[model samples]
Target: DQQVKQNSPSLSVQEGRISILNCDYTNSMFDYFLWYKKYPAEGPTFLISISSIKDKNEDGRFTVFLNKSAKHLSLHIVPSQPGDSAVYFCAAPYNNNDMRFGAGTRLTVKP
Candidate 1:
């Protein structure tokens, strides 16, 4: 059983448009949530995160919202740029930062 699921394998969007990525989880033990952005073969980098106790977290053009009651989370980017095109992953804290990740969501910020 997949403890976490990101239904869409990928997404594409134009530059300056908004990009949204969604994630869901079945594990109730998860307490911390994080979003990571990655490009090609490079390792993922932490973007934004939210705790189970909070509903939302934001940093500049990136924002993450957690709905614990529904075990759902999303990442939103406003006016995405061409440089923003990449795969994004949703992660949850477990076993000393052993984060469980979604397959990924690819955003194509076409210029």
Candidate 2:
């Protein structure tokens, strides 16, 4: 069974608009939730994270919200820029050792 999943495979928005990405996971042991952005042929770069103890975390234009009761999480980007177009992934540490990632969501910011 897949521990993490992104129901929406892709999303598009006009520049300067808000974009929301959703993620769900089956594992409850996951304590550290993170978002990463990736470009083709390059490794993912960490964007933001929220600890299980908190409901929300924000950095610049990016924010992450966690609903532990529902085993769901979301990433919100405000006033998204064209450069923000990329594959965004939700990840968490698995068994306190390896990291597990969801099937990424591709966000397209139209000019």
Candidate 3:
């Protein structure tokens, strides 16, 4: 069974609009939540992250919110741009040395 899940396979938004991606997790031991953005051929690069102790974290146009009680988290992009279009993954460290990732959500930002 997958510990992390992304129910939405894909999402689309007009440029300069807002984009929201959702993620859920079953494990409570995960204290660190992270978001990664991946282009076609390149590996995923870190976007933003939040500690389980905090409810929200933001960096520039990207923000991550964690709801521990609901076992849910979401990534929000404000004024989404075309360059932001990519497959986004939610992840948390597992086994203290590795990570567990959600299925990923492909975001399309159209001009």
* Steric clashes per prediction: 0, 0, 0
lDDT of each: 0.89, 0.94, 0.95
Candidate 1: the clashing residue pairs are: none
User: By TM-score, how accurate is candidate 1?
Assistant: 0.93
Q: What digit string (tens of lDDT, one per residue) describes model 1 on residues 1-111?
A: 677788888888888889999999988999998888999989999899999999999899998999988999999999899999899988886668587888888888889
List candidate 3 segments past 4 Å from native. Answer: none
lDDT (tens digit, per residue) of candidate 3 on 1-111: 899999999999999999999999999999999999999999999999999889999999998999999999999999899999999999999877899999999999999
Off by over 4 Å in 2: none
Task: Record all residue pairs in model 3 with backbone atoms less than 3 Å apart, i.e. clashing.
Answer: none
What TM-score would each prediction reach against the true structure? 0.93, 0.97, 0.97
Clashes of 1: 0
- Name the lDDT value of residue 40 in candidate 2: 85
lDDT of 2 by residue, 70-102 (tens): 999999999899999999999989976799999
Q: What's the residue-level lDDT of 110 in candidate 2? A: 98
